[model samples]
Target chain A: MIHLLAFGMIADVLEHPEKDWPWSADTAMLRAALIKAYPELRDLPFVIAVNMDVAGGEQPIPPGATVALLPPYSGG
Target chain B: MKNIFIQGSIAASFIGESIAKHQSKTDIGAHAIFLGQVRADVIDGQPVSRIDYTAYEDMALQKVHEIREAAFDKYPLTCMHIYHSLGSVGVGEISFFVFVSSAHRAAAFDALREIVDAIKADVPIWGKEIFAEGQGSWKVNQ
Candidate 1:
């Protein structure tokens, strides 16, 4: 199992960890973890804000300390 | 410690109060201020009515603290402040205010521009443009 966390919006997953995130796992396993976290958002249009800019365009999130799901900031 | 975030219809008063609190010092030769206001504009043929701003406060505060340190190191400034709105700001309303006080005009000008540019490029605030023509779009400081 992998650790996953979300802010601004939740992910689209059917089987979320239901526990703490930022855990460890391999690349494929973590993507599975993300898929589990937000089943609804899976394969949907979304962006991640690592620090200030949008990230994770097409690739699965890298297993590291510099990754975040950037929920679309709709507030003006 | 210093007043940074201002909201609602009273933001102007807050800006005024901040300015009033500044006393001209004989050692400082220049004081520069920049205020960014919400403007009604056209976006992709739609007219924007206002903007709503949101941010990750924890990260933003960390960035702001770094900016302060960098500004003082780069410029001979006595003090500086940055204020940004947290919610919706209607057209013609002020959304951001940056103030810089330095011992010289050149340093103050350079520092002011740097601060604004850094905030635009590095801050984690999101801007949603609400249109008067009944449409809207998300915009990031680019």
Candidate 2:
């Protein structure tokens, strides 16, 4: 299982800020699965981060890795 | 990681204290400070009276660490401090503060703006605009 975290609108879309999912794959696959699970995610803009680092492309997600879905930053 | 998240609005006294603490470091010739106030915004006739902030703490601190490192790498900064509100901040209250000091005015000024901009663009923090009567919407940084 891998730990999944979400923030902002993405958390609202997922209905939870963090959770554990029984899935282990690269960042791209996780994005697809998430969009498939929650169609609302498809309409939202966000980026995937693995282990606190923003994934540049189809970055691999090692087992037990922590993944985060971060929406556009609104900080100042 | 260094905790930059403050529970509420940043007080003027706190800012004064921060400056006072730096006076001992006489080598610093310039200090640039940036404050982000929660503006009372009107959206669809609903006025935003406060902003509720949130973040992924670990990730945010990590990203901030990176930003801090990059600034130091690129600038001859003597000191840099960043603080952001994490809870409800009322309109006209200070929610974000970036303090940068250097041996010269030019580097301090440039680093302060870049650091503030980087936080807005790269950090994971979010602000929910709470209007009067508690009606709210997500804030979009322009």
Candidate 3:
């Protein structure tokens, strides 16, 4: 299983801090699955962090990786 | 990892104490401080009462560590401290504090500006501006 975390507005949309998903080799497929499950995520400005680092959609989703959806930062 | 995250608002007493703690370091000739307070911005017809802050803790810590290291490399500084609130902070309450000390005023001023700018642009912290009536909107840095 792959663990996915959400923060900021994305967490509000997901309604939880983290969620589990069946492992998928393709990063694009995983993103698609997520958007399908949470339609509201499609419109939000965010980035995907794989293993605590920002990752591109083309990058492979490593097995059992910790993923996070991070919204644009507003820190001062 | 260094403890930079504080819950709720950063108090004036805490800021005063931080300054007092540095008094023993007489080598430092100048100190610079930057404090970020939550503004009561009016949106539409409602006014913001507070801000709810959140962050990806591990990543934020790592990023802040890198930023600190970079700042040290680029500036001549005696010490630096960065503190950010993680929970709710009401309007006019302090949400972020950055302190920099150096032997010269120039270094302290330059380092403080650079550090504060880096934190705002690079840190993965988020803020939700909550209105008086319980409604809120995610804050976006301009």
The runs of at least 3 residues in candidate 3 whose Cα sits more than 4 Å from the true structure, single-residue gaps closed, are none
Estimate, for each residue in B50-129, the C-alpha lDDT of model 2 and write its tens digit. Answer: 99999989989999999999999999999999999999999999999999999999999999999999999989999999
Give candidate 3's root-mean-square deviation (CA, Å): 1.3
Residue ranges of candidate 1 with Cα displaced over 4 Å: A1-67, A71-76, B1-3, B133-135
Residue pair clashes in candidate 2: none
Q: Considering summed lDDT, which 10 consecutive residues are worst modelled in model 2 chain B?
A: B130-139
Q: Give the candidate order by descending lDDT.
A: 2, 3, 1
List interface RMSDs for the candidates, in order. Answer: 4.4, 0.7, 0.7
Q: Over the full model, what C-alpha lDDT does candidate 2 score relative to the true structure?
A: 0.92
Colliding residue pairs in candidate 3: none
Q: Write the per-residue lDDT of candidate 1 for residues B1-142, one digit (tens) a residue.
A: 3445556422777778877777655676788988888877777888788786766665567767888899988778988988888777888888888989877789889999999888876665667787876566766443
| lDDT (Cα, tens digit) per residue for candidate 2, span A1-76 | 8899998888888888889986757887888899889999988989888898886677888899989898889987
User: Docking category for candidate 2?
Assistant: high
Native interface contact recovery, model 1? 0.16
lDDT of 3 by residue, A1-76 (tens): 8998989999998898888978777667777888998898788888887888775456678889998878899997
